[model samples]
Target: MNTNNKRIKKGKVKKKKRIRISRLILVLVVLLVIFAGAGNLYYKSASKAVNDKSTKSVLIEVPNGSSVKKVAKILKEKDLIKNKSVFISNVKGNEKAKHLKAGKYKLAQNMDNNAIIEKLIKGEVYQDGVKLTIPEGMLSTEIVNKLVSQKFGDREKFVKLYRSPKEFSSKFSFLKDSRISTLEGFLFPSTYYIKKGETEKQIFEKMLLEFQKEYDKKVKSLVEKNKLNLYDTVIMASIVEKEAVNDSDRDIVAGIFYNRLDKKMKLQSDAVLQYGLPERKSRVLYSDLKVETPYNLYLHEGLPPTPIASPGIKSLIAAANPKKTDYLYFVTNVDGKNSYSTTFEEHSKNAKKYHQERNDLLKENSSEKNKTGNDENDNKEKSKEKTTN
Candidate 1:
C-alpha cells in the first residue's frame, strides 16, 4: 500500500513539471512574434516614402507658435511624411528637435520620414514668393517703384496705401502728431519674401512692424536721454544715413549737424537736394542746389519738411546719441572716408583736393568704358565677316 502511494505522488510531480514547460515555451513564442512584428513595422516607417506616386510640391505654413506635435501633424496632413506617429517618435529622440522653426515650408510628397525630419530640424523652407530687397536710404516713391518693377504690387496702389492716414494711423502711435503725412522714412529696410497672393497692406504692415520691433527699450531710452522727440531723431537719422560714408562716421556726422543746428547754420547736405530733384544725379550740379524744394537743406534752416529717406538702425542710434565733437563740417575724401574740419577754410581745402581726385577717377572710368565698347564692336564686326565668308 505504501509503495503504490509513493508511485502516485511521483507521477503527479512529473505531470505538473511537463505542463509548466509547455506554458513556458508558449510564452516565449508569443514574445518572439510580437518583437518581430514591431521591428518590421519600424523598418517600414523609417524607410518608406509617404507617396511614391505623387511628385507634386505643396506649400505648408507652420504657424508662428506651433509645437513639435503640431508640426508633425501638419506634415502628415500635407502628405509630406509617411506617418505622424513615427515622425513624432523620431523628433522626440532627436536632440535638435527643439530648433524647428516656424515658417512657410515648400515640401514634396515623395520625401521619406528621415528626409522630412531633417528638413524640419534645419528649417529648410521653400521660397516661392518674390524676394524684394528694400535697401537703406530709399524714399517711399523709390520703394514703390522697386515693388512695381518686381511685379509684386501696383505702384499707385502701394503709394496710395502707404500714404493713407487711415490705414496705419491706428496701429503705429508714432504716426500720430507726425510731421510727414506719407510713410516716407518709417519703412524698415530688409529682404522680404512677398508671397504670390500677399497684399500691399500686408507688406507695409510687416515693414512697419519690423521698425516698431527695432525701436525697443534701448533705442527709446536713448531718445529720451537725448531730449529729442522720436520724429526729429528719425528725420536726422535719415540725413545721417545718406551723408555718412560708413557706420563709424554716422555719429560724427550727427554731431556736426547738431552743432550746425545749435549755431543756426544751414544744413547744406547734397543728398537732401537730390531727393527734391526731378531726376536723381550722380553729382549735384550748381543749379540743383538752387532749386527751391521743401527737402532742400541748403535753403531750409531746420530739418526738411519730412525725412528724405529711410534710415537704418545704426543711423537711428547715431542720431539719438551723437558723438561730442567741436568739428562742424565734413567732406568725403578720395578713399570715400570722411575728412572732418573745425573751420570753413579747412573744409574748403579738403573739398578741393578730394573733388579733383574724384574728377580724375570719373575721367578714367569714362575712358575704360569707351575702350570696352570699341572692343565689343570689333568682336561683332569679326563675327559678321566670318559669317559672310
Candidate 2:
C-alpha cells in the first residue's frame, strides 16, 4: 500500500508540472501577440502623414551631400513629417535612398513620407511658370536687362554675380580657367523656364549648363584639334557673330581673322571698334576708329580682352574650324554681298567701287524724291490757275 501511494503522488506531481509548463507557454504567446500589435500600430502612426487634411505647400532645400539623417532632420524641422526616426527608417529601407538629389522641392502638408521620399529620389525640383528666351549674340548686359524686364531678377545682383566667376567655377568645369574673370561669353543663349524664387546665381548656372552641353557637342573636339585657346576662340567667334551677315560668310570671316592673326597684322574689325562705343551706330565713322579703347582692333594687334557678344553655335564652329583661304580682306557691298580680296590694292578697289555705288544710289533716291515734290507743286499750281479762271 505504501509503494502504491508513492507512485500515485509522483504521477500527480508530474501532471502538475506539465500543466504549469503549458500555462507559461500560453501566456508568453499572448504577450508576444500584444507586443507585435503595439509595434505595428506605432509604426503606422509614426509613418502617417503630418497633416492629411492640410493643403499648404512648403518649399524645402536639401543641400548637396546631405545624408539620410540630415534629410530626415530637415523634413522634421520643416514639419513635413510626423517622425524623424520613422523617416530615416523608411528612407534606409528604400533602395533609392542613395540617389536622393539636392534641390528645392515643393512639398505639401498632405504628403506622406513615401511620397516625399519618392520625390527626392526622383529629383523633381520646383520650377516656375515663367519662360525666358535669351537670343544669340546678345551681350551679358542685354541678357540681364531681359531678365530684369521680365521681373525675374534684380539688375545689380546679376551684375555682381556675373562679374564674380569664381563663385560658379567649382560647379562648372569650363569656368575653372584662371583667365576667366567674367561670365560674359559663357552664358549660353537659349529659352529657359525660370524657377520660382530662384536666385540670380541659379539662373546664370542654368545658362552656363546649357553652354557646356553645346560646347561639348559642337565645338570642343574641333577646338582641341586646332590647338587653340578656348577663351580666344570664343572671342573670335563673338567677333564673327557680329561681322558675318549670313551663315555662308561666317567661316570665311573666321578664316580671314585667323590669317591676320598669323601674319601679326591688325584685325581692323569694324565690329570690334563698334563694340567699344557708348552707343551703336549703323555705320562706324573715321572719328569712331580713333576711339582709344582696348577693344579697338585698329590699334590692337591681337584679340580684345573679352568677347564682344555671345556667339551662336554656327559662329563658334566657324571659329573652331575656319575655311582655308588666301584672302585676308573683305568688304560688304551696298547690296549686302561680301567681296574677298587677297591684296590691299584689290581690297581698295572693291571698297571704292562699293562706296561709289552707295553714293550713286543715295543721289538717285534724293533726285527721285525732289522730282516727286516738284510734280506735286506743279499740279497745285495748275489747280490754282483753274481756280482763278
lDDT tens readout by residue for model 1, 1-389? 69999999999999999999999999999999999898778767655676778789889998888887898889878877766777777777778777677778777878776677788778887877778889889888889888888887778889898778467879988778646588888898887789888888988988888888887744778999879989889889999999998899999999999998999988888788788889886556555556899877767888887788999999999999999999988887878799998887777677667756755675689875564453444443432322221
* Steric clash pairs (candidate 2): none
lDDT of 2 by residue, 1-389 (tens): 69999999999999999999999999999999999999889888888888999999999999999998899899999999988988888888898777689988999879998999999999998865688888889999899999999998899999999899999988988887787888988888787888688899999999999989899999999999999889999999999998898899999999999998999988988788888899887566556666899988777888998888889889999999999999988888888779999988788778768766765675688875564443444443432322221
Candidate 1 — what's its lDDT? 0.81
C-alpha positional error of residue 137 in candidate 1 after TM-score superposition, expressed in Å: 2.1
Best by TM-score: 1
Over 4 Å off, model 1: 1-58, 75-100, 107-125, 216-227, 362-389
TM-scores for all candidates? 0.67, 0.62
Flag regions of model 2 displaced more than 4 Å.
Answer: 1-128, 364-389
Index of the highest-lDDT prediction: 2
Worst 10 residues of 2 by lDDT: 380-389
Error of 2 at 312 (Å): 0.6
